[model samples]
Target: MSTHRPLRIVFAGTPEFAADHLAALLNSDHEVVAVYTQPDRKAGRGKKLQPSAVKQLALEHAIAVEQPEKLNTALAQQQLAEYRPDVMVVVAYGLLLPEPILTTPKYGCINVHGSLLPRWRGAAPIQRSIWAGDEASGVAVMQMEKGLDTGPVLHVERCAIDAQETSASLYKKLAQLGPRALVTTLDDIESYRERAEVQNHDAATYAKKLSKDEGKIDWSDATQLERNVRAFNPWPFAWFELPGGKPGQRTVKVHQASVSQTDHRSAPGTIIDCSPAGITVACSQGALTLHSLQLPGKKPLPVSDLLNGYATTFAIGVNLTNVD
Candidate 1:
């Protein structure tokens, strides 16, 4: 337990992951003097200016919030300086804090990262874990420096990545787990004598930011489970282009799938069958069954339901021609 007066902590983060940590802090003994999040940006189909989850939550809590375009700007730095926070807690803040801002707070800025450092040290750690087929990954709360996730780890929390876990599911788990570890880190911070260890650069692996364009499905070169299912879950979903039959070439996005290593007879991307349960496709090493999918102007539905409405069979030997 912290023996010192409840420290006035400044928080910097954006997105839902950061929002979870901010919510946790609100319930703690520490005082959050200010919150810093990215500016509202165009979102959704209409591209309306929507505030970040953190910003919205902060407003509800009645906490002072700042949405600066750049931390390097003198006005932004001046605003942060005025807070005079003992420590800054940063969790997925999106923008990089400049050198002046990094050391502005008394204890410097601490980041709650979503990976076991020095393993994943970049953006999109959760998505990278699933894409890399990692069995388990966790969160690390570290003392931030200028580099990206290059800070020394102070506390870590591990969680298993089930074969069925997707980015959305794993993110939820990490969001909850991160707060527990953050509280623990703050308790340690109160002691004020612990040394922040440097990360092993040789062991570091970078997780590059994911873009919509990276979500394209390549059935010919990828496993049915990897491309047809796991890799395409939330954004930039894995999809295939069906040849022009009636209107034109339509794109179908596959969302949920299961892999089986028992069968390896059928060629990859060969639609074994499509039923109410899902669409089963053959892979090079095994088989995959897709349970959920989406087509143009359609919501996600079971492969079987999709067949009933469209009456189109993803029959065997139908090659899902790659567009890109």
Candidate 2:
């Protein structure tokens, strides 16, 4: 290890991704003076109030934890100021930092963004990158500013976007890559700050937050639909409706799929073939072979296994409606 003195760090984040970064900080030589996460929210089957992953980890380590609804209040800012941090690290913290909180620490604030700067600069970057067919995705350690994710880059860690990479898989990959990068940046933050590169505002593209309505499968482009299936897995999953069934009864979630180049004259959403391998459905440009799927209130299963019980539902020649 270098001879640089360890700095006092104040970490603010929520969710599992944030927790991973906090874990790294806890292992480092730096002193984590305090932790700030969102207030506990109701979750799960019982809808009970639950602590965030970061909060839970902080409590386990006996670190001081703060759960302010918003940081704009005087009490919140005063509490954060009491930490006397050298630098504040922010991940997926959910709540926006006011100007006072931004300048509270000696080093100001730095964020661990989920995408390469000047490309994807907002929420849902991971999912949007896969959906937009980006060849690579990575994390950027930057000096936080008033503008949303438009910060000077201190360091970056990149990784290839595999052909079959899903948001869940890519998320895990970045989660691992990000902590190491964060720790590396903290190792010599002053040097990194002096050499920080400004982002190009011209090439910036916004990654808007995802919604359940966005998950409705559009059969117009099989290639894009395939990407959508991968991007939306485990949340607002890509779904389509059976032709004859009623509104709520017809929705089917696609868990796994691949592009099929087979020639097909059937209309978009038509079932071209149903076999043990998969269910090939026609699209406007090409066909998509759905491997795993889930019906309403049912567990996801491979098409071959689903065929054993619902053969008629996915039978050949049946039209799968694209419910918008």
Candidate 2 stretches greater than 4 Å from native: 1-3, 322-324
Error of 1 at 189 (Å): 0.6
List residue ranges in candidate 1 displaced over 4 A. Answer: 1-5, 190-195, 220-224, 245-249, 262-267, 322-324
Provide the global lDDT of candidate 2 against the true structure.
0.93
Q: What's the lDDT of the predicted structure labeled candidate 1?
A: 0.79
| Residue pairs that clash (backbone atoms under 3 angstroms), model 2 | none
What lDDT score belongs to each candidate, Candidate 1 first?
A: 0.79, 0.93
Per-prediction backbone clash count: 0, 0
**Tens-digit lDDT track for model 2 on 66-134?**
999999999999998889999999999999999999999999999999999878999999999999999
TM-score of 2: 0.97
